[model samples]
Target: MTISCPTCKKPSAPRAENKAFPFCSERCRLIDLGDWLSESYRVPVGPDATERDGVSEDEAAGRVRTPDDLPN
Candidate 1:
């Protein structure tokens, strides 16, 4: 069977021996990795999807105001 590299879309035969299965080569694999690390690629988050560990964005940013921390 034939498959295409997810990064460069190059068609090639897939084999278990291929180190970069979905990708054509190590270069293509690295490119795909760079995209993920750089936030160029993102998994879809639904409205119902919650943050991991239940930490809201405000809490994560330390924006939750406390009485003692309130402005005078």
Candidate 2:
């Protein structure tokens, strides 16, 4: 049987013993994983939506300004 790597699209021999199935090598698998971990691939989200910790978007956007806002 034959299998092609999903990343490089290289032809690889299908081996039941091989741990890296669907990928030809560890490098290709790691590269694919790095793309995900480093956000080279992204899931689309709607605009005007942001992640906030407890604070409403308006409140977060309109935070108080003070002289302390300036770095010493």
Candidate 3:
């Protein structure tokens, strides 16, 4: 199946044939990585981690959370 490169939105090589399957070339792939390292790209987060998973920010970071932090 024909696919488009995520970085440049151009035609990309097939996964079986291309090392950089999602990108047209290594240049485009590195460009995408640079964007990530520079924080130019980000994934949107929703809701607090504590409310969602019952794991508080402290717990998530490997610290102890106080028992007094009640969920609303």
Best by TM-score: 3
Question: Over the stretch 1-72, how does candidate 2's per-residue lDDT look in tens digits?
Answer: 678987789975466755777788777777677677876553324563345433576786788687888988
In lDDT terms, which candidate is top? 3
Stretches of candidate 3 above 4 Å error?
Answer: 40-72
The global C-alpha lDDT for each of the candidates, from Candidate 1 onward, is 0.72, 0.68, 0.74
Task: Give each model's clash number.
Answer: 0, 0, 0
TM accuracy, model 1: 0.48
Off by over 4 Å in 1: 40-72
> In candidate 2, what residue range of length 10 has the lowest lDDT sum?
41-50
Q: Output the TM-score of candidate 3.
A: 0.51
- Comparing 1 and 2 on TM-score, the stronger one: 1
**For each candidate, what TM-score against the reference?**
0.48, 0.45, 0.51
Q: How accurate is candidate 1 locally (lDDT)?
A: 0.72
lDDT of 3 by residue, 1-72 (tens): 779998889999988888998899887887788777887543323453235454455467875576677685
Tens digits of lDDT, candidate 1, 1-72: 789999878884476868887888887787778778887543334565455545766566786566898677
